[model samples]
Target: MFENFDDILNVDDVAKALKIGTSQAYKLVRSGKIQAFKEGRAWKISKLALINYIMNQQ
Candidate 1:
């Protein structure tokens, strides 16, 4: 579904994809609602993980 985004997405990318605020996106990552891993101090989410999260939400 997210064909326009990169395979690896950042918080801002996720926010745009979900049409939510960056804080909300961060909350998802922090709360483990969306699967993510930290690279240094930033969160990285795979495109497949995002798709899976969306699918599971429905």
Candidate 2:
């Protein structure tokens, strides 16, 4: 199973994992529905944060 917050993922990764569209993934980040950071010119999401968000959604 996946583990740890150090596992940084990109927008596509988040989309695939969550079965969402890339635009929706970006929307989540932009709307604060998810946590992420911009590294250089790319947006990165923490696996732990995604999991936490999913859990809290219930």
Candidate 3:
């Protein structure tokens, strides 16, 4: 699931990739911990941004 995803991922997708809850994923996006932008009522996160975030954590 993590290996294949669209360029922009929804909060649910982020949660699955990180093995976290949707609520926590939303928090990460809301607080700018995970690079994302609001599109209408949805959050879209970049694949590169997610990768960067994971790398930075290490």
Candidate 4:
């Protein structure tokens, strides 16, 4: 699991965690596939949410 990630993550963090590009990270968030929310102008994804997504994929 994501032991090094924080409770909340940004696009770059998500990209690093998923081993994907930042653009793809943004697309995942925007497409509602990653379960993110916007805070002001930035998107925020919870570590638990990402875990859930990965679990569902399996």
Backbone-clash count (model 1): 0
Which pairs of residues clash in candidate 3, taking residues 3 or more apart in a chain or in different chains? none
Which structure is stronger by TM-score: 1 or 2? 1
Error of 2 at 40 (Å): 1.3
Query: Stretches of candidate 4 above 4 Å error?
Result: none
Per-model TM values vs. the true structure: 0.95, 0.86, 0.92, 0.94
Off by over 4 Å in 2: 1-6
Which residue pairs show collisions in model 2? Answer: none
- Tens-digit lDDT track for model 1 on 1-58? 8899999999999999999999999999899999999999999999998998899999
| Candidate 2 lDDT by residue in tens digits, 1-58 | 3552248888888888888999999999878889888999899898887888899999
Candidate 1: lDDT of 31?
96
Question: After best superposition, candidate 1 residue 9: deviation in angstroms?
Answer: 0.3
- Sequence-dependent TM-score of model 4: 0.94
The lDDT of each candidate is 0.95, 0.84, 0.91, 0.94
State in Å the error of residue 47, model 4: 0.2
Q: Which ten residues in a row have the lowest lDDT in candidate 1?
A: 47-56
Instruction: Return the top candidate by TM-score.
Output: 1
What total of clashing residue pairs does each candidate reach?
A: 0, 0, 0, 0
Candidate 4 overall Cα lDDT vs. reference? 0.94
Cα lDDT of model 3 by residue, 1-58, tens digit: 2568888899999999999999999999999989999899999999999998998999
